[model samples]
Target: MNDLLQHYEIAKKNANKYMRKGQLNAYVDALIEMNHYKKLMKAVIAN
Candidate 1:
């Protein structure tokens, strides 16, 4: 899961770079996905 989070972070960073090229939606999606991942990680750890 840590690895997944790292991958998501990298993807988010890449998406950020393209925000000027019409990737704002992608960036927002990445942010949402990252937040989902955080929630998932919390749930897993609680179990």
Candidate 2:
């Protein structure tokens, strides 16, 4: 759980940095991918 949160934090920071650099598309894509991964993890954990 702690490791997953750490990875999410890192990914959030990277996405924000990309957005600040005007890489909106990349940032959005990264965010979407992150959310998808989180959802999948939740589903797996619920099993």
Candidate 3:
């Protein structure tokens, strides 16, 4: 769970960085990855 949160934070930062750099594709990928991490975190919390 801790690892998942770390990855989520990293992905969020990467998304912001990519957006600032105008890298649309990379930003979208990072957003998708962030969403995946969020889902996993939710599942962990639910259980």
Candidate 4:
């Protein structure tokens, strides 16, 4: 969770240097995926 967030933040910061919107969007999607998985896991564990 933390790692993914950090990676996303770093990627966003450096995304302009690459001038690739798709690449930056990929990272954003990945960050959302990580959040989703984390929540899913938490629910499963609680059950």
Scanning candidate 1 in windows of ten residues, the lowest lDDT window is 11-20
lDDT per residue for candidate 1 within 1-47, as digits (tens), equals: 78767866886776677675677788788778777777877887898
| Every candidate's CA RMSD | 2.2, 2.0, 0.3, 5.7
Assess candidate 2 and give its lDDT. 0.79
User: What local distance difference test score does each model get?
Assistant: 0.75, 0.79, 1.00, 0.58
lDDT of predicted model 3: 1.00
lDDT of 3 by residue, 7-45 (tens): 999999999999999999999999999999999999999
Candidate 1 wrong stretches, greater than 4 Å: 20-22
- In terms of lDDT, the best-performing candidate is 3
Clashes of each: 0, 0, 0, 0
Question: Clashing residue pairs, candidate 4?
Answer: none
lDDT tens readout by residue for model 2, 1-47: 56666667777888989999999998998798679768766876798
